[model samples]
Target: MSDTSSRIAIVTGASGGIGKAVAERLAADGLSVLVHYSGNAATAAETVAAITAAGGKATAFGGDVADEDAMGRLFQHAIDTFGGVDVVVNSAGIMPLAPVVDTDLDTFDRIQRTNVRGTFVVSQLAARTVRPGGAIINFSTSIMKLQMPTYGAYAMSKGAVEGLTLILAREMRGKDITVNAVAPGPTATPLFFEGKPQEVIDHIAGLNPMQRLGTPQDIAEVTAFLAGPGRWVNGQVLYTNGGAA
Candidate 1:
């Protein structure tokens, strides 16, 4: 383990949406954050600006999450900039909705490349590089349990994430590091709202006991918990949906 006083975190997909929320929350928790984004450099800079303006340390880094070499460089950047890494949140992913039969193979492959392969690449590097007592969090979705139509491809990717979360925790037995996945349901991020009708959105929201869409902050709270004091809660998939699944 590195110095406990200078903890650092790397949050992929930190440009906007849930990733941005998690980055800000973790920065508020006193860890210097490396904000990773694939594109949209300007949005990523905005995230960093928000963090820094609020007396937190943050830097924007650009890279393709599924590219092993790029992700490796991202890890190196974190170490070079922040001294060492204590937490890694693999929140970079894409969700393309379509029924299994209707989904194109190209679309299926793209989803897997970003979500499944991306998580695996990041998790592997995190396992090799993170200091003992650190945490690695991957994103999944509660919709997997809901078995909603037009989500087969996305759900399949997240299911693989759940599996990876459990196995990685076991693989890190003696390291004192925790590996887990956060499965959110119908969060009202740009990603969630894209291409969906208001009626569809309302219908989905009504399924949850809360009867409302979750905000990015809601999910960020859980990420912050797992990254910090929630050390005992390892090898688990925490469903952050409001009684929807």
Candidate 2:
């Protein structure tokens, strides 16, 4: 990490949803943010604008999360633009669903590439770049424990994310940087509701003791804590699921 006065963060997939919320929340916590998006420049711009309007520092960068060169540049952009990166949040992923038997190989590969490989790419860069006393957060899903039938490949990829989170935390032994995965259950994000019907959504929401779907802000709060003051809470997967499992 480059030496800088202000704490800085790079949030991938920050154009909208939980990523956007986390970016904003971290900015509110006084970190300069680099909001990263895969393709949605307009939405990414909106996130940046919102942050700036709130008197927080932020910039938007566009790149494929799974591309090494692209992600390297994304990390470099934070160094050049924000001085250095103190935190990195890997929240960019795809969640297409299908039972294991019915899922096509291409779809499975795509999910792994984005969710698992993408996290690996960003985590690699973060491991090399994040400042001491920083954090690296990757997103998992509570559905893995729920064992929903159609979530086979998605859950498999996040299982790999959990493995990466723990291994990376240990690998960072003396670095003073914490690594953890946040497993959220039934959040009301665009990705979560894309093709599902209201009844299906309702059913999933009811599985949680809270009897309500999570908002992006709910997960963002957990992320903000991890990125800021939760230093002792490393190498764990926080299930922010309202007792769903």
Candidate 3:
């Protein structure tokens, strides 16, 4: 079992952004991490390097999150590398902004495939394989509650994520596993800045009472809690958005 004393985590989409921050934080909290990336091997390696350099343990792995076979292997690989899985953080997602009428069919499908199917695939594997007392943390967006325009497909995808997260928590029964989703509001990550202009960004930032976009670190703190000591906080979508929702 390759020295199973330390807890282990599988953090998808960890090559950058919110995923990366969660990986680093979990490692800092003393869990060995499997840093999963979709296509950015270089950045994934960098994430691994940073962890190891900080006297923490991490490895970079790549695969399509929605691929059942691929993600199944991913779960196995985590067990092989770190004895067993204690946490599975589904931080991999896509955000495409377009009004419902203007959103392309292909784009909507792509968003759902990655955001919804990908989460389902990983969460399914986590449901089956995560060791007792483990945690499965899924990503969602507070934008869904805001009901903003130009986010129809994105919000729909996140709604599915929330539903899957809650039901899976119940299905796990007395397994000692906690399933929950973290819904962040306008975090300052590459994903959030991809299409917004400066003025629009400022306007949205100002809307929050805090008057700023959430940082990746802010969200990571909540994830760390859920993965570690927040055992009673299950089957809930925590709005970790500084009241931005």
Candidate 4:
């Protein structure tokens, strides 16, 4: 339809994985999307192309999610191009598996910068800029609930995102904005497959009642609901892993 009448979404880290799925799903739902990528413009282009080829509106923008200035521009670009933003999905994150004692200080710092500070930067901007009736969705992980080893450092960062999601929802009481986080369980993404043997994957998949790994579309369905009809799902984290929690 028309640009002025359509909802607009900015899906950070939309180059692939859950981020790409969210962008495509939102676009399919009639929202014009700005596909944001950190260092993967080509893949981000694929996301945009897929949306457009399906008769949905989309374009890619590259920027560091952790940089406040860059993220501010991203918000502005959405406003400038699509009239205003109705949804913001902070799905960009880095997961480096390590036990706390074995975690390198540098890697830990990098995780904090991209996962924690990055979510904060984009979130505050969404708070100020996303139009009323909009939604802010941040990505956390099931690791927080899994209590699994080698995810300690990553879990710590997501804990902060959870705190931010809940507090922001309350802070937006009169603003009519919903702030929620989607903590997905084990999913089949390229990142998830790295270095894992088939047996290990099968074991993890079997932990859930569904006895399968979640697909990116599984997470996207929950996100699409929150961004649209699920307005009451605010200030909460939806564990969307086929009962994998």
Candidate 5:
């Protein structure tokens, strides 16, 4: 657990559950993962060949996180392939259940354009390209504190990502970035039993109270401890859910 942050991570839906376990735990704590993916480019090249066959330092990218020119060419292909972009991680989303009177305004605007405007266009490009001590995280759902019931349009798009991670941690305070928002609960992804049944996925994995169901490395170890403890845990949303709420 030592390779300390030199920084360079992108991670949006990195081709699997919880963005491939937060891009292999942020490249096993070293951080040089760009992974990202939209239409599974061969499972994002098998999550960059299993993070370069485990010697960590990944790459595989793609786009369409609600496309703003494919998120500015996915942050210009992670700043021309790993040279900038500190840590973004908005685990690309979609959870369609309906039930707000059978909601459908084009499925609530395509789940608020991919979970609230793809985490506000990747936190407005990590608030203008993160670098100075960067970190953004943002993916949310413990069914918004378990207010479950066909998951109100995926908890109203993760309640606008917990109010946009508290207004982007007060709009990146002094730019010493740290935006935070990890809400995971019922896990066991395949997009959380994507078409349910199998006794409704064994009753949603026994309604999680540690009765099981949550492990994309359990929300990638609380998003690798909020992108490596640049602590103060700004803005905060952290539900990680074994308690199930």
Candidate 6:
């Protein structure tokens, strides 16, 4: 890690789960993190505290990822506080499972608004504001390849993220910036088992070759590598799923 004291990173959905892990990882890697939470102020504070406690710099901010004005302020906050942003990690997403036919329009629209459009807005802003050698790491899911039942809508949303990451990589060619996506398989996050029973959760843990559910730390390590030393990798979705894919 370089000085990165002035190198800011915006991590959406940073209040918990994968987002929180990625934010902490980036902070430990020396980036000044802008922890973005949608509605959980208390959790956001905890994330900021963890970063600062580790002697890393961080600040918590709240805003709707789907709102353009909110994204503008998010970007502005990073610039105003840390001088400029060098990384943008689009980790805010919701996964509500239902068969395609049974999936209501409202749920479908909500997923798209946050997963696809939110990534677009944030990536667009990053393209304009991020300095040379910056990185934009978008989140996707291995389920897109698995095509599991009841995951059609959710996969569709993450599929859009995969597309955006690839295109944005080429779009930023010659700018010394890299755009990439990381897809984790069956991670053991609170969001992953929201309503599932213990047995269901246990089943998922065994699905991966490692015989365990993926951890947020596993995904965060890959993300940090991409955001830093792995800059040579571009427009690719690195699957860190215990060979499940």
Provide TM-scores for the models.
0.97, 0.97, 0.97, 0.97, 0.34, 0.97
Pairs in clash, predicted candidate 5: none
Cα error, residue 186 of model 4, in Å, equals 0.2
Model 6 residue 164 lDDT?
87
Q: Rank the candidates by lDDT, best first.
A: 1, 2, 3, 4, 6, 5
Off by over 4 Å in 4: 1-5
lDDT of candidate 3 vs native?
Answer: 0.93
- For residues 35-83, what per-residue lDDT tens digits would candidate 2 score against the true structure? 9999899999999999999999999999998999999999999999978
| Per-model CA lDDT versus the true structure | 0.93, 0.93, 0.93, 0.92, 0.84, 0.90
lDDT of 5 by residue, 43-104 (tens): 98898899888888888768878777888887888888777887888989888896799787
Q: Which one wins by lDDT: 3 or 6?
A: 3
Q: Which stretches of candidate 6 lie over 4 Å from their true place?
A: none
What lDDT would candidate 4 get against the real structure? Answer: 0.92
RMSD of each: 1.6, 2.1, 2.2, 1.8, 16.2, 1.0
In candidate 3 the C-alpha lDDT for residue 241 amounts to: 83
lDDT tens digits, residues 198-243, model 1?
9999998898899999999999999999999999999999999988
- Write candidate 3's Cα lDDT for 106-217 as tens digits: 9999999999999999999999899998999999999877788999999999999999999999999999999999999988999899988999999999989898999999
Scored against the true structure, residue 238 in model 4 reaches a CA lDDT of 93
TM-score, cand. 4: 0.97
Per-residue lDDT value at 40 in model 2:
97
> If candidate 2 were superposed on the true structure by all CA atoms, what would the RMSD be?
2.1
Q: In model 4, how large is the Cα lDDT of residue 100?
A: 90
Superposed Cα deviation of residue 230, candidate 6 (Å): 0.5
TM-score of 3: 0.97
